[model samples]
Target chain A: MHPIAEPSLLLNTSICKANITKMAARIRGWQGDFRPHFKTHQSAKIGQWFRDAGVERITVSSFKMAHYFAQHGWKDITVALTCTPIHTAAINQLAATINLNILIEDVASIQALEDHLENPVGVFIKADTGYNRTGIDAEDFITLKKILAHLKDTKKLIFIGFLTHAGNTYHARNMAQIKKVVDPALEKMLALKTFLRKEFPLMELSWGDTPSCSIYNDFYGINEYRPGNFVFYDYTQVQIGSCSMNDVAVCMAAPVLATHPQRNEIVVHAGAIHLSKEYIQLPNGNISYGKVVKINHALEWDTHDIIGEVKSLSQEHGVISANKKIFAHIQPGDILGIIPVHSCLTAHLMKHFLTTEGNFIEMMK
Target chain B: MHPIAEPSLLLNTSICKANITKMAARIRGWQGDFRPHFKTHQSAKIGQWFRDAGVERITVSSFKMAHYFAQHGWKDITVALTCTPIHTAAINQLAATINLNILIEDVASIQALEDHLENPVGVFIKADTGYNRTGIDAEDFITLKKILAHLKDTKKLIFIGFLTHAGNTYHARNMAQIKKVVDPALEKMLALKTFLRKEFPLMELSWGDTPSCSIYNDFYGINEYRPGNFVFYDYTQVQIGSCSMNDVAVCMAAPVLATHPQRNEIVVHAGAIHLSKEYIQLPNGNISYGKVVKINHALEWDTHDIIGEVKSLSQEHGVISANKKIFAHIQPGDILGIIPVHSCLTAHLMKHFLTTEGNFIEMMK
Candidate 1:
């Protein structure tokens, strides 16, 4: 069979290793344990890299993912989702196999779990801080008291403290602003934990999300940290100051398929299927889906190696302009490195990964 | 298993069959043979719906996809990509197995294919009528003519006239405007076919894409039509006037896992994994990643009802809220139907399929 290489994806393992090492150091410096969220990487091989770096505890989004990782010998896992009755059986199966932790935000969900679960699963009450998307209000200590009282009455649930994902940090303009939002939110959670202790007396606060944990070092009352995307930082994290542009290790390497001279555009085989159609609005008001990092035969990233701008994209083609000085050097046979706006979506679309040094890594199971 | 009766996908097979029947009739009425593209639905079982509706030919984006459908008894297929030297062996294998038609725009690519293959294969010259991404420009007809002449002398390639996808129709404001852009571009291809017939006679003039084929009906000179997304219309198709809001059959149904009363937002279990993060900019200048469809009695999908708007989406949750009237009725117990902005990505993400009547139909295999 001929090599199916047109719309192939390339992952920079060197950069990926560096990002993980850097994140490991950052979390260690903050005096916090790093439980990297595997939802961003999804690959067990990539997860193995973290495991080699002494990361035993991990976080996943679904029960299926938990099972997948558990089979791969990941001992401690927190299924980072609100416990659902639909997924209770899977959760039960996973908990029966390993140290599985789950998140619950509602008393009704806790009651359902209390009725059906075979074993006591470690439950973390999802706190709704200022982000205000999932958790119950922290001021409503009565609600927490009611759930804790019910769990205590049933004797079927184990409280592993509280967990909160300060997702609002993603909306911040800069690191200082992200700190301004997250610090107060963390403080609010600490106060809520203190109030909840009046009823349960033994609770911990577990805070996650790469934006808050990657940028800030002060983990005052937070017991555990779960930052996933730091393993493969992208344009968004660079712009947010969570990582430098040089630290962004993984990029979707796509081929220049066809060139359009009439519109001064070159169509790359990479489109939404390879590099997801996620756009980043730069500080200079430039809205680009991705940034071209470097071309082929280059070791380090060329900062000015902005080969082309994506003008339009379809399922199979990314239309880039060849009007830049770099474009004159980039031929149709050249490979272009692109920093995806969102690494999660890009990782999902790919089936395999090609490293910078030409090692082929299979991403799909 | 607790039935997991959250907002889950429910495909109406009868509705899907009827939609295919309607599309086939429209293509026949327009005097074009229906060669439905399978990228949108990506299910061999669903492709059978088109075959049952009298579709004999098909188109796919990649050779792997071509092999995928070919195994399902599809004979006539076109790998709708710019033919490259790297994939010539796989193309030959597929062509040997089925009546595979390949697309090539560059002269060097065609020459490379000519040098590699001994078996006769049908080749369609992909022309850039307006969408300046992949195809050779119409202004470059002299170059195309030279390439065609060279291929004809070899007597191995069967010239199948011109084929163009008016992808610019995707960016058009409305259906009428999309037709205005497509009609002229299609006419240009017909003109190319007419001009080429004197030197090298050709049989077919192919055109496709949901925006052009689904929205407009005037394919007078076009011989074969290919459209995939008509089976599962998305927010993009709804905006382009290809399908009505009711005609959209597939939706990501997710249960409200948590609600924050203070922030007036609720988080659903469905996120980028279930429904892709493809956003649609509404006419009012408000951009939402997806629209909330109707929920059923089982909190699945209802044919006649829908509620709320998805305000923001994260990796594993969709934050939805409407006005006070909408929020007052919404609770943590309810399920919300979310119609994705992009059907292809969303459908691919959902590796499993469930029918409206609750048959667990496996589509990915």
Candidate 2:
């Protein structure tokens, strides 16, 4: 019943609910609007858990996801990733029904929305505070002004505020390094918010990134919070000092296929197709695809006792370097719990989750 | 219609058919049973294309895949990965209907199959000739004898021959390096076959690995050939000299989201969830997630003109470092074709394929 004879993504509901409640209260304490991102756990049932925790608005990364949550009755939905012209049809459809928001960085995107959108929709100028992944640079006021001017002429598009996902915090090694990324990002975002406030007084400041939201308490100038990964934190967050290992709510229960005790290795059925190829480089210079822990009698992983690390992965096989104690005690049929390096990718690959209570939660397949 | 307003896995059916024909003819020339592994494409329609090329039997990586191909009229099927007890239910079900073969390396796995299998199934001893990923070592005769003895006592398991996957050939840089890995693997496999043939005459020799099968011509003693990646040769295959870039049959049609001319980068809507996180290291010490090529008027990629490389990927965004010419020509709504690093992982992540002729090909979900 636990491992289910195949690779299963196990979700601890108690831990997940606690995570949602804590983050909701923290954002409330900062006096900011809590619009938690739903990209991590794309499930309607999990969304209800957030609803129970007083979260009304949520963020997603794609138009498909926006349409999914919209169908499931999420009213205030933001497609957090930048908008392209190709998704205009979806944008128009979602905007027709829900309180939809989309991100825009340039005049081209705004022009696309104006050209095709039939219903009014909220727009957030995606600003690159520091992470150079996407979004317009916060200091690039020329482009920002041009986008804003174009949005001003549009009848169907409403400019909301500046939104930035400081994803650079993911690369931070510790709390101090996370602060190093967050402090400048906050400054740039705050500066942009101040500049835009003269014209749009109600323009909100949206900050998202799990590390900054989980580690730093001071959300001084931010009006909205949108951290996604805090719901089911993983080994990467623990490495970044965003959360402890105990806070991770998901684990991959994989069946042991074969063991090479001479090589101190055990092969599991779960591989890149199950847990994803995301890995973490340890301080000792070893790469860990995932951390292995034991499943207790209650079907929960013993986070206090990490038994091994997944060393390598092929398409459908994971090679784990087990400790002497576990390797000696393990057999080919035993199920071992593997805490994935990145929970979002793992959850996406898995497509659904199995709660510890033996209930299946469906995602947006 | 080309990009379809979202990331689509574009399969060039002509190139794919040509790859199948060429590989089928080469294996015929070597007088080996061509049971091409269907794990790469996983599509039933693509399996029909193999039937068109005169391939009767097939190889898969899992029990689920075996069930899928068996449903589509494949009679002789082999699940090439090591068998575990947890999958005995699927094994028994498949074996009861089709001529199913399962891989076994240890006595424990054999015992599991022996205890639960209701119908007689063919069993192949997976030998670790050189790749230490899984399977029994070729030199471990004592353990092999024990496993054979356990199988001898079983009523429902028929002993097939030895099989090995020389996956080490994937790490080879050139033909010479590939030969270096293949020669030792074949020698050890032949040695094991020779030693076992004294007791079990007419035992077949099965060998599978895309790199060795694509590069080396000589399959002297191998009775079966199982190469999966040749169906959709990827960037990693090109780097490993398994196939040229022109032979690659699939490309990800990703919609361009934004262009950062200041940074010489263009971000596309496809990311790890669409294209997978597998990467290749260039000779210059830079990492390449995928190679970028322009989509031509025929809805196929211009493989000759390598335009850029996907420098990095996040959850739903791939940042491509494009050349000046392509960058200038590219816009926010344009579609760029990306040849993935590993086609199997990419295909798995994509879930289905859209043929160049505007046809949707379904895979096993």
Q: What is the TM-score of chain B alone in each candidate?
A: 0.93, 0.97
Encode model 2's per-residue lDDT on B283-312: one tens digit a residue. Answer: 888899999988975678898777689999
- Model 1 lDDT per residue over B262-283, tens place: 5656678887767767777888
- How big is the positional error of residue B96 in model 1, measured in Å on the Cα after superposition? 2.5
For candidate 2, the docking band is: medium
lDDT against the true structure, each candidate: 0.75, 0.90
Which docking category, incorrect, acceptable, medium or high, applies to candidate 1? medium
- Please state the error at residue A360 of candidate 1 in Å: 4.2
DockQ for each numbered candidate:
0.54, 0.80
Which ranges of candidate 2 are over 4 A from the true structure? A1-3, B1-3
Best by lDDT: 2
Top TM-score hit: 2
